[model samples]
Target chain A: MPSRASEQVINLIEAGLRDGSLKAGSRIPGERTLCMECGVGRSSVREGLRVLEAFGIIRSSAGTGPDAGSFIASEPQEGFSRAMAMHLLVRSFNVADTIEFRELVEGWSAAQAAHCEDSAQRDAALAEAAALLDRMDDPKINQETFHDLDMQFHTLISALGGNAVVDTTLGALRSSVLGYVLAAVKQLPDWRAEVEILQKEHRLLLAAVHNRDSAEAQRIAVQHIRGFAERAKIGLQQ
Target chain B: MPSRASEQVINLIEAGLRDGSLKAGSRIPGERTLCMECGVGRSSVREGLRVLEAFGIIRSSAGTGPDAGSFIASEPQEGFSRAMAMHLLVRSFNVADTIEFRELVEGWSAAQAAHCEDSAQRDAALAEAAALLDRMDDPKINQETFHDLDMQFHTLISALGGNAVVDTTLGALRSSVLGYVLAAVKQLPDWRAEVEILQKEHRLLLAAVHNRDSAEAQRIAVQHIRGFAERAKIGLQQ
Candidate 1:
């Protein structure tokens, strides 16, 4: 918990946001104004802002003008992703448990994506995911590139599910384990060999989603995760 | 993103914990020492500690010897629960989306509980859950009592499921909506009538778990949540 003055400032700011007084993408009041309005010291206001920053609720910019201060972030997921990753690194949150939770949410996401009403826009998005999978076939690519593409593919699936909550949770969870995943990629002896097998699975999964086969979509999704997790032997090395 | 110095201090402290240098019951390095080691000001160390405090990772004591300063918390869930609740309050998190996510997690939890192998400890936990349903049948009980029992019932199911991830996530999500649920209780036109229906649902849910009926457990669990969300009309007023 923050100090009393800090808590007061946080509550006041969050309340404003909730009631539509503070719109996303708009700058929050400056430190001086907040200190005055909250009747708190500048330090207290700064502390409150720091908490928000850690939660990925707000972002600050440097160097003058209207866009230079903390703003209600229009997109806060990156903030969340970073904070959660830091926590995961600290081992305060377990990796294996997170993967298990991931299985359930992602299974649902796959099913939901399959069940999502057909629309050209959604179809285009699914095509994008499939294309990303195809792109992952390149053996010459580095682990970082492959991981980014994989992240994009998974994120797109959750987004297609049309569940904002699942998208956020899945994104956060995936981001949290990213360091381990990247490490696992390096540990993998033959990236090309494994890539072929994984691409085949991805094709099956994409086909299921495309065919609106919810059960197969979920089945393949869960199996793909469990299968890779087994082969990768994640969390085993250290 | 905490200030640079704050980040260094956070990293140093968490590294200590990861290496078994900072036990849960032990006081973390004091501000003076941390400032010296991390090359940061006292304010920076305190700021980092405050962020960790907000995350529910550590707690500080007022003035004293070994009993004082910040200690690695034995129970950090309360801190996570509050941080999440505050986030939920700000519409930075959505309730309807959260409930939808809840259905999937809790459904999986129910299925897991039903599939849990027979054991004296597990059986006793199941029995306790059943007893809770029975107690909820007490007509003289107040809304507060019923809600507490309801919370316990759900908590036990997730716990018995034996996934730390689900338990932590469920706990935080439940705590986040507590203010809404408590308020909804007051708004209900007929608490007794609704409580009766809810109790029956709980009984059926418990029986499914008791019978090791995984499919039924999952189905009933999902339905129970959907039913209550509809009745409480959560997020409806807003």
Candidate 2:
């Protein structure tokens, strides 16, 4: 549990945010103001501030001038992604649950990419994904490089889905499972057959996106993930 | 970006988790061991450990003993929820995107709850949800309490969906938007009508879940949330 002082600091900041008094790029009240309002010592205030900073809620500076103090941050993707990835790494969440989540989020992302974003942007993103599929055909490519391309291709679709939450979220889910995924691929008895099947799935998904077939895109994405999940059969003990 | 030493710490833990060398109840290497292995100072190792602890990936202690050192954590919800709620407080994501995500996850969770899980467990979970609806019908319930109950009702369904990843993910997403959701409810022009309509929707959803109608349950969940989104008209602002 968080200490009372730290919780107080968090509640105060949340209150300010709720009231629109604090916002992106706005400086947090300095230590003295926080100490008075929170009725805590300088050390407590600093400790609370450190927690926020570590969470990426605030960024601070050693230099204390008008433009050089701690400020509430707008960029949340990095922090959220890091936390999500770390939590997924703890092994409490099983392989099947991760695959289920991936199917849900990635399916939603693919469908939304075809249906939600503006046409030109959606097409451009799909085209980029298609290009990645083309690159994956290289005979000389190592498994790691191939995996990165696969991630990049799917990340493009997620981003183009036009929701930051989904993009950041699906990205984190993918990363959490990525190590095991690569290991599974490396250990496949029929590596060439695996690559062929995965690339075919990607092509079908990309083509559906290019055609602006939202339902088909979603279906393909889910089926593709299901195929991988079945083939991987990843155990808790790697 | 994570510092090199911090990244090293993350990779080491991830590798262990992947290979089954480290596990849920196991402590990571101590500070001295980490310093030597990571080739960094004591401070860097401590910083890396702090980051993991803050993310709820690990739990730590000040006391020095075999049983008192850092160990991998099972509970990721509290930390993830805190991060999500704080980020949402900053108004970084828009209302439309939030609603879209809720619809997707809630829809999938409802479908899964209806289609998967043992019949006895599913009925029991739906019964609990129905009971919450009954409690919501009381006129004495304040808007704040009603909102919390509403959240609880949805969280129960998400958990019973039998996917821990979905359960935790949707919980964080709902919590992230909860403050604004309650505020939106408080400001509704026709509060009584809103309550009646929401209860009706909840009843229909519970009925579908009870009947094991996966598609209908999913449809109702999405439509119900969409109704709330329309009523709230929640923009980027509170």
Candidate 3:
């Protein structure tokens, strides 16, 4: 259970946010001020602030200058990913469920991207994804770099789908399972062959989206995800 | 920025989790012990522990007893919902995007529930949902109770879909938008009539799932969500 003092501090900050008194980049009160306002000691205030920081809702600076003290912020994707990764580590969630959820969301996102009404935005995202594919084609690229680019490519496609919630959820899911994914890659006997197959699938997915073939894009997205999981044996149920 | 000491403590705990040294319900080291082990002060250790508690990974009990100190736990749903709610309050995500995402996920869940392979599990979930609907039919119940039941009904459907990730995501999304939803209810001039319409829709959705009508379940799920949002004016694009 959290200390009552810390809860008080958290409640105060949350109230400030709900009332629009604290906007992004708005510097919050110092520890002393928070303590006085919330009737709590400095340690409790600090603890509450740390909790908020862990949630990526605030940023703190070291100095007493203009850029000092804690400020309200919004970086929920990092916090979401971190929380998800921790849960996965503790076995609170399993890899199979995560992959299943990812496949569904990514499939929907791909279809939506293909059906995107804004041609300019859709084309821009496709170009960015193409560039990521081009980077992945470099033979000298390591597994980690290739994986990072791969995640970025998928995230870009989801962003083009015009749903921020889906994009964030997919990004966090990818990050949560990243360790297992990388380990699986390392275990593969033919890494080059696997990469070659993945590159081909990526090209097909991109082309489908570029041509506004919603059905094909969705089909490829689901197939590609399930194929990788099967090949790497990341989330297979016994 | 979190203090370096707190970060050190957090890293230590995460490492323990990753290495299988920590399991759910296992008691973690005390603050003094953590301070010594992590080379940090007691305050830093407490701050880090507080952060973990905020993430729903640990629970602390007061006093010196068998269950006194913090114990590892798995309650990511609470943490996810809290983080999402805070982000929503800060305008990091708008209601429109959330509703759109919920529609997609819930529709998928309803279809999956209808197509569930395990008849026993599917029937059990449908029975639970029917019970919730019965409770919602209480004419004297307040809007709050009805809304809570409504959310549980939807969450149960998602669970029946057999994806924990989707279940948690939908729960968090519903909670993130709960305040606005309740406020919209307060604004309705004919709350009773609205409740009647919602109850009818819920019955139809439950029947569709119970009958294994996947197409009808999916269609009703999407329509119900969009219809509620339209009627409540919760996420309208002004």
Model number with the top DockQ: 3
Question: What is candidate 1's lDDT per residue for A1-238, written digit by digit as tens?
Answer: 7788999888887778656788667688999999999999999999999988877677899889766999876666655555455455545567777778888989999999889898998889988998898789876887888878888898987788887768877888887777677767677787677777778878887888889999999998898888777778885544
TM-score of 3: 0.94
lDDT of each: 0.80, 0.80, 0.85
Ranking by DockQ: 3, 2, 1
TM-score of chain B of each: 0.90, 0.88, 0.93
- Candidate 2 lDDT, tens digit per residue, A1-238? 3457766877888899889899988899989999999998875676566667667788776675667867898785667776777677776677788888888889988998777646687667777888898899998888899989999999987787788778877887888778878888877888778889999988888878777799999999999888877887764353
Instruction: State the DockQ of every prediction.
Output: 0.43, 0.52, 0.63
Task: Give lDDT tens digits, candidate 1, residues B69-92.
Answer: 887766666665555555565566
DockQ class, candidate 2:
medium
Q: Please report how far candidate 2 places residue B191 from its true position, in Å.
A: 1.9
TM agreement with the true structure for every prediction:
0.88, 0.88, 0.94
Question: Docking quality tier of candidate 1?
Answer: acceptable
Which lDDT tens digits does candidate 3 get at residues B114-177? 8888677677888899999999999999999999999999988878887777787788888888
True contacts kept of each: 0.39, 0.52, 0.59
> Model 3, B63: alpha-carbon shift in Å?
2.1
Please report how far candidate 3 places residue A21 from its true position, in Å: 2.8
Candidate 3, A18: how far from true, in Å? Answer: 2.3
lDDT of 3 at B22: 90
